[model samples]
Target: MQLLQKFKLGKSKKSPSKGHANYAYTTARVRAMKSKILPKETYPRLMNMSIDEITRFIGESEYKEDIDELARIHDGVDLIEHALNRNLAVTFTKLLSISEGDVNFLVGEKLKKYDIWNIKTLLRGKYCNASTEEILEAIVAAGRLSYSFLSSLAAKGTYEEVISELANTEYYPILKGYDGTNLSDIENQLDKMYYAGLFGTIRESKSKDRKLFAEFIRMGIDLKNLVTLFRLKKSGIADPEMMNLMIDGGLRLKHRDIEKMMPLSFADFVSELESNPYWDVMADVVRPDMVSLIDIETRLKKHRLKSAASFSHVYPISIVPIMDYMLSKQNEISNLRIIVRGKAANLDDDIIKEQLVI
Candidate 1:
């Protein structure tokens, strides 16, 4: 708890002049939680367990409270998934609570991205006509939006009503143009708007910590854009406007480059990548007909994690370390979830191995 207390991201309103001291307490706490993240050996054991066994095992771990709370309402993969979301929400909220200074402010600001995610989830759920409970299950509590607000949005019975509710929020204005469209168009609008907001925030941050944070997010956006571009090209979408949906900042690729590459084959795309800075890390994943979106995403995540970890070492006193820990923890959680699912599906070890991030 000492480490957790020290690593808080909040700043005291009473002491406006104190700089990094605001993060002292929160940073310490974050460090302690970082220490508690699953060890490398834990995954091997988890990989051998069924979903139920994995749930029970997590009940004995840091997720004990969430598992206990969710077990009555869910079982199997549903239970595990809900418990994971609950734990994530609780952990991120705890992080928010412990923060006090500028660090707190910045973290809170970043967490708003989760609000954007929640809105997208609500819109998608509404379009699909999912039940209220099903929609509620998708809400990740890791963002700045209140649970009450999210619950209200999730409970909305129609897409129109959901959009009306969101109209009061920041994303409403951005989504206005997409009203009365198919779900795909709405989803694309959400994606573009979210990244646009993220880049806007990055542009405004002035601190070293903020710069690192911006870069981390930008890298993720760039990877996503790259993947989307590749996918659309494979689908034979030659129109540049269609490709523009995948545009994101932080990449050296220009609009012209994306347009010119629209008609190229996947092999040509791989060749283009081979000539770029990302070549070394993405070389193995490059190929014609490479449609493994999950694998490409996993590779991108690993690259981001490695970059964040390296940056943290270089800027230990800044927010980089805390952000690094957050990203690492997320990867750990995702990896464990994959392992659990693989075991439950009874996939062969080699196949599972191919899916794993570690």
Candidate 2:
């Protein structure tokens, strides 16, 4: 993957915090954020907490502002979910504010997932007849799409109006022809479009520093593809039906590979994730119990976050650290939501703990 010799852009591609990039400064900030991230050791202590205790605990963490802002109107899991999403949005928005050049481009590319997320939120909200306020809370304004645009789209009365709102964007072309009633179909198109755009951006880049960034996307796509593949297989879905859900362009897992594997069984893929038979290095974090799908998904995500942090070190000056920090912060928000929701539902501590990626 070393393209330094093959492609030279005649610019200081390795610029850190000094001169061209604020890399040194950004890395320092990212390191500090990483350090302040909820310690893995603290998850056990958190699992023992009740709803009120968990809310209080969250108030004391980095999410205090988000909590205070939303606590006045929302309560319990709702309060926590909105607050967590807000804080996650703020965190990623801050990443973009502080970054520039390749770092900015790479982070922006990765954050496009939120763009897709916001679109899905719009679709689901419209389908369920949810309020604009509710959908607004779910929108993370970290991607190129402005908060104003999303807010406007969220306020639209119908999904057709929403799609019309996005007529000028990349999502327009794919979403325009879809039957608006089938949210599942639209969501699949959005996912494929998002990944296709991301892969295209990285592949088009001539910078060597961006190589690892591409690798990161490949890893993510691979994980997502596997998770979706297994879910479909376990449900006894026919091979012919998975084409839309299956994402293309993975590191080792391709569309053709998926086509060949789907008609067989899920056991082989389960074992791969369970024991890391193929990718031995990822075994430690993604050791799924095979009983619970949540466990498998959690394992995959936890490993993905862990690997992001580790890989950041390998290219500290590049986009790695900033992007890694973004994922870690996102994981923090997800963990908090899981805890809040689990506790509010009166689920046991151990059950809540099982869902924690920390």
Candidate 3:
């Protein structure tokens, strides 16, 4: 709590209490946080180093404090992973606190998605028969939901109890029907409800950031749909079942688009996607140096990051910049983990770089 209060989530007195957003100071704090993002040049240098060298390199960077605290207990990639997740959670929790008024509304609404994630994580852990400690480690702790709340959720002995605990949230309605079904189906319900809740908020929003956030949500939906479609296609699932699995509200890949691509082979769908606005996002599938589901998903995530950065540059004072920084912080944690783990495994530099979202 002391650490959380110390940072104050980039808040300053300049933040508005009502009416308008406090773009000035809100962005000021966000910019400072964004500065800590790994430079493009760093990846090139780190790729050549061994795992020990990579750990040493991270110790000298912004991760130094986290690395220092955990170094005595864990080493190598595990140390890096724990430190990074801790840092990521702290950063995001700060963002949720500092926001106010319109900025608060936007950030808060977006952060609710993390609660959905926690529910999913708990359900998954219970379904897999994973121990409570194992489930606890997998949590990100970045959401508006408190650490205690999530911890309690993780300790639940059954999926029904987990869902019952979440009954007060929007997720309960969707999950209630699937109490006895497979966890995968329940997880799929959570995903659909989350996107649906997002679009519902979008409908009620009157802020300038509405269009920006709407697009961000759409990009997420499209990527999610693509990933789902590909997996279902590979499984030989029928169109109706695949459609049920996909969440709507995607920007480029609409109902018509999905309908058109459903009957075609995966190659044909990739070719069809190449000509649309989603080409850059799906480009990894059409032009990957290392063809893989992982590569394709990484590219899609990178596209969203680049788009957020570009949007923030053009609209610096808006909510876009804050969201951009928050996302960049999360991606930094992930990218560092990728590099650390990849280096620890002694994988080739190119292979590691291919998996990076930056």
Candidate 4:
């Protein structure tokens, strides 16, 4: 507690300044949050429990407030989903609140990506004609947009109205061309725009902290592009048009390499990946039909988690640890969701293990 007070004092001293003080505060808060992430063994236990048991388990854990509040209105998977979103919102909003300087600015910018997510969610809900309550429940609430703004957009009820509401925000210009299209097209456009903005923001940021954030984002993009490339190849879609779906700024593969690799046979594609930086990490999974796209995706996520964990220690005072904790927490949630669903479906243990990313 004394150490935390000292750290908080250091942060407050720098809060009024534009320099290192903000980073200190953000890093301190992030470290505290990281300490609260579930242990690895928690998921295996969650997997064996029923949905009601799972809810009770989470209620006894860090998600207590959210679980308690949502329990009255929802149950089962719906309850878990709402609790997750609410907890995400509370956690991220706290980050914004505690950060003082450039750390605050950087986190705010990175979080704008969530705005893009919310917009896409709203658009999809509108297109599907889903209820406002359903759309509201689906939002993650970890973005730069206020809760009121997101709630308003979700309640608007029409694709055009949602698009028009977002027009005044940073995402409006990028999504303008895709207006009135299918929800998938809108989703794709939003993804492209969000990533493009992320890359641009990375380039503009001069702080070492900002650079670390960019590397994490790049790692994610690389994994996503690799997955897309492999999936398209497996589906027998070799056209150049398919490459358009791949995002840029990956540390491992360039646009040209992605384009070139698209034409390769599955064997060649696996060999190409095996020879890259991810080779040693992914080498064990490179055999015959056993290497399904889902397996590759799971491996990629593992690699990213490992990479993020390593990077966290490389610069302890930066945002990397916070980002790593966020990813790990989300992965824990995803792993639990998969296990619960798998158990509920009565899948065999080996089959369930095969599907888990952990």
Report the C-alpha lDDT of model 3 over 277-307, residue by residue, as the tens digit.
7776565466412245776778778887898
Candidate 3 minimal-lDDT segment of 10 residues? 11-20
CA lDDT scores, all candidates in order? 0.72, 0.76, 0.76, 0.77
List the pairs of residues colliding in candidate 2: 17-24
Please, what is the TM-score per model? Answer: 0.84, 0.86, 0.84, 0.89
Question: Judged by TM-score, which candidate is best?
Answer: 4
lDDT of 1 by residue, 1-358 (tens): 4345336644432322224345666767887888898877887777677777888899999999988998898888878877887888888878778877666766766677677778778877876789988888889978778788889878777877877877767777666665555656766666667667656656664556567767777676666677787677667666756765765565555556666777776677667766666667777876777766667766776787888879877876667777877777777778767776777777786677677676
* Candidate 2 residue runs with Cα over 4 Å from true position: 1-21, 267-290
| Between candidates 2 and 4, the TM-score winner | 4
lDDT of 4 by residue, 170-215 (tens): 7777667665666687677777877777777678655576678888
Query: Looking at candidate 2, what is the lDDT of residue 241?
Result: 74
| Superposition error at 336 for model 4 (Å) | 2.4
Instruction: Summarize candidate 2's per-residue lDDT along 127-177 as a digit string, tens digits.
Output: 889999988977877677778989999999998899888888888887787
Error of 2 at 93 (Å): 0.8
Question: How many residue pairs clash per model?
Answer: 26, 1, 0, 0
